[model samples]
Target: MNRTNSSKSIRLLNYIEEKGNKLPHPVTIFILFTFIVIVLSHILYVMGTSVTFEGVNNETMETEMLTVEAVSLLVPEGIAYMFSNVVSNFTSFVALGPVLVAMLGVGVAEKSGYISALMTNTVTKAPKRFVTPIVVLMGVLSNVAASVGYVVLVPLGAIIFLGFNRHPLAGLSAAFAGVAGGYSANLVLGTNDPLLSGISTEAAKILDAGYVVNPTDNWFYMFASTFLIVILGTLITDKLIEPKLGKFVPTEPMGNQNNEVSAIEKKGLFWANISILLTILAIAILVVPENGPLRGEGGSIITSPFMSSIIFLMMVIFLIPGVVYGVVTKTVKNDKDIANLMTSSLETMAGFIVLIFFAAQFVALFNYTNLGTIIAVKGADLLQAIQLDGVLLLVALIIITTIINIFIAADSAKWAIMAPVFVPMFMQMGIAPEVTQVAYRIGDASTNIVSPLMPFFPLVVAFAQRYGKQNGVGTVISLMLPYSIMFLVCWTIFFVIWYLLGIPVGPGTNLNY
Candidate 1:
């Protein structure tokens, strides 16, 4: 009986995988869903219904438009207004701009062989056992470059792991865990931080008329999360993941790959390090003293001009050193090469450009329908009705988000859908949007390594296939199951502890309202 049940479960899983693989590309699916949402919203708007959440109270009696077209359509007035202003929604275009710029710089770093060379050299120098954790950490840090971590680091993890005497799939799992599972825990704010903040601000306005959630609201929490993720990720890889693949020898003879820094490379790296240090010193000198040019009148980092342009500073930090390395190593011949490198970076952002276009349209349509607002309001009412406490509420949210992540896959899209509802609800219940955002982030990130729908999941499969052709989605998922489960458990525990201690998650951010 047990064998029969196991066989049935395996067959069901196989059927699901087969169907999912045959489905439309995620970008296409987004476009189709956006169109459906827009059409339904417009139809509902034409009918007499109280689609606007703000005006929906018990005293409000929604008129039933008796006409067949109106009754069938169920359109609301505010939705029509929203549909009319589709072109005016700045959120659609503005959200994608930073990602484009960040990706451009990253493309240069990747296409010019800088990323590959750095990874190869690092792996060669490190001991075989340390490669997995280092790759995971690198994947976590690569969030600075936007989606480059998925494109570059995930595959490299498998390769670097194979270079050692370990299971390459385990290496891929570690990297994916860091890159996707810990995506929201970057030390520095990225394009996502602002986008989510904007959504939260809009949501919060429903409850607190003048409330504004800053883009950097969760920065401090995320900074601490970076360390938490690193330590947890390292422990999982070393203790659980590596041990499971017992005594598996590599199919191919290990190549004597030399990644050592030669005298010239060492000298170039030294100068690069010095240049970065000098750059930091210059910035410190400008900002540290009272009445310094970069400092605001308040002499606070939040109010300072230097802090405002931190991303550009990051670009300079990476670009200057990369250039110095290129010149010293003779990889970059002239200014023309530098221009080409930057331009090349922009070129590789084509996929992101396409994805963002659809994503923008979908978000705009969701807003136009007023469905997001109504859902948020209703959800808030239901949670209040239940009268759950803060900790339970957070746990419930994490569970809901994790389940949604399994099917939805896209972090930005899921957050865009969820933030409008939860942010305001939590704020009204005496919780900060930053706290809610952190919870959402943890849930969204923890499942990415195990979710087959993630865009990079197939790529990781291919990387694993290099060693064993039998490696597929199931294989990768099975390998990563431990990391995903451990991350979800340990990371949630850490968040609960942090909440209990009443530690500020970010700068000028609090756990409570």
Candidate 2:
């Protein structure tokens, strides 16, 4: 029986890998999706199908009923939109800017040998037992630093594992799972907290005029989830994902591999630390005053200009340390060397740049057709009439949310569309809005690893290709499947058990209002 079970497990994984690999290239997939969106848009428009829901109006900043009708791309106006918006879409796509800019800094760090030296030192000097857990922990905590996980930590993970003489793809999978799959679960409150909570509050207001949801309302559950993700990511990497990757032999140079830090490298690390400190000090000076340039109106951190420019800040954070390290190690002798390093880094993004162009169009096309919003509205409507109660109802909500998330990649947007319907419906049934929001979060985060529509999905693919040039969408997805399944199952169970015991989901937030 034991052998049979093991065989079945191997078969299941192989099947997943086979199916995933069978799919076309990530860029081709995006192009195909865009084509499908166009056809579906025409069909739905011909049928005169549409869905309207209450959404927070961006211009008015108030809850208003919003209607989305399918648009036929065959129509003149639709064609015009497609043509006119293509450039804008590619230029303004959310993921494109952050990923490219962040990579600019990381590229500098990588090419300058700072990242390699750091990882090598960490591998040799740090205790082996703690390395995997530490990597997972960093990935989880990266949420607080915004999109750092996608552009920075994921690749660094591969490098770190490579330094340890382990399979680099396995490390990449672990970090991606924690960073992307476990995105919604964190030990502390961050920008997303307010974004989702604000939407939940607006939805709750449809039932109660003065309902308010704070950012930290999900802190306790999320704190627990942080540890859960770390443990799960570590285990999945060590026990499952790594074993599947087997042995990897690196094809590229990974800097000085003496396995011992040279005196110059040690000096470089010291200067890098100083550079990081100086960067932080400069940022603090910019944001600490009431009238500072980085402070938002009324001095709110969440709304601050500093928060808005986090990507740029991250670039500085990485670039300074990298240049200092390079100079100290004599790898960078002049300004031309730094410029050449950054240029070399950009060259590596040729494949990624091509991929993002199509991805941008696909995401724009989906939104243009309004299919994502319509589907989410219809899905929420279906769940509302199911008449579930108590823990079962929450489970249903999570499942539905997860399904919707596979299509609608934007967290706040999905919640905005669904919240008006479900939040009010749940409140009418004696459930709290906070509880509903928490459930939606679980579904939202768990599937990020598998969703091709996610803005950063292509970027992760690019990261993976740096190590295993042949690795594709299938490889990354197969690696992350366990983490997704395990996190969703375990997180939902934790929520259900906590609910049964009448535990507060957050501060003064109960299962029911």
Candidate 3:
């Protein structure tokens, strides 16, 4: 918590950041990787590289030994196929459509100021003694709408702390810890759930053709983790981070820094809550009955129309509340305002769309080569030979993902590369893809606050400097390091225990395949 403990680590992280900065952009990295796969495919093909594994013949429902050979994309037929499938590959990308649709609803909520009002109400109204927990909890929930916490709640945390006569850095760290460190934990499903699950489903199909990984596959564990993160974040902030910074003495009292919610905003927030309740009630009516239309055969919600339509449901959930809030506050006067707000939200996604275009090609080409299956079978054989199955295997993956996350900040890009290899490999070891996906998420989130390569890291540094000129990247990282370490350690342990207990990770997902 002290400067001495973290000062040296900050220097090392800065050096790591420098090296990471020197690397190509994420899009370039994927493009270069695509070329690497192409080259490797040819060489391996020429060298007669292949793996014989016991796999199910999905059509026949029989277990058979299959020889998966390296397919060369450098060949004439390969080139022709690539040219023909390029557009389809991008368009049919599993993660693309669902994420965009979810974002459309999230866009309305954010643009209508509903998300902002909710966060302000949650933080500013908390009792001082309970402020740390409340801020951290709000940060965890803010992920429901995507990146809203970073822009709104983080600075709000600092301002709330300053108003309470506490060190602003401590408050900022707490919020950052929850927003980034608990990135994958949420009571309500976010855009990331479907985005990741879609990718995971594709990866699983490589091994089992009929396998389907739902967006809610990791919901149970993630819901439990929300509370775990709040408790841990609060303790680290109040006990370690805040005390280390000592007391704050404001040179100039921030007079005009208003933290109170205006009367109109409060009214908008009240109606927004009502709207959310009505939406949920409507959905429940369609989903809860024994013979409900949304229910699947045998009244199963997991395999029902409701489950498959989660993205649409999510869109409606946020969109309705957002529109209602905007109407009450006069932010949305008519249909034109709503349409314009949705367009603006899509504007923020232009960069993500570009990234997904390249990433999709990379994944599609990798699958086309059959390299993913070969790698998975070979890796599984090695791990099984070394007796690294079960909990240790999951633990090792979490650590590896944590380290990789520091250098590669984009979660989707990292998962795109990793899932093809790891998901099927673990499936071969009798571990489910849902478990593998959750492991990746935990590792990805734990180091987010400390990773300088994260897009929001510098923005958070700016938030810190607003309170004290001396506050920089090091100051922010130092303040956050304890929370990161504790989250990584405790969360991994919690997952291990959860795994050992044979708890179902989500509605229909067991730890084993």
The number of the candidate with the highest TM-score is: 3
Cα lDDT tens digits, model 1, 350-413, are: 6656666666666655654555555555666777899888888898889899877766777766
Which pairs, if any, clash in model 3? none
- Between 1 and 3, whose lDDT is larger? 3
Better of 1 and 3 by TM-score: 3
Candidate 2, residues 1-513, lDDT tens digits: the string is 012223554456456545554555566656777788899899999999987677655556677787767888989999999999989877864445555676667677778877666655554565777778777777776675456567767877787778778887877887888788788888766546765775676566554556777666788888888888888888888997787777886677656534467889989998998999999999999998888899887876656677667667767788899899999999999999999988987787676567667766775676667665566567556656785666887898899988776666656546755676677667656688999999999999998887766778889888888875776666666677788899899889988988899888786577886
* Candidate 3: regions farther than 4 A off: 1-6, 251-255
- Candidate 3 at residue 412, lDDT? 91
Query: Which pairs clash (backbone N, Cα, C closer than 3 Å) in model 2?
Result: none
lDDT of each: 0.68, 0.74, 0.90
Candidate 3, overall lDDT?
0.90
| TM-score of model number 1 | 0.82
TM-scores, each model vs. reference:
0.82, 0.65, 0.98
Residue 354 in model 1: lDDT: 68
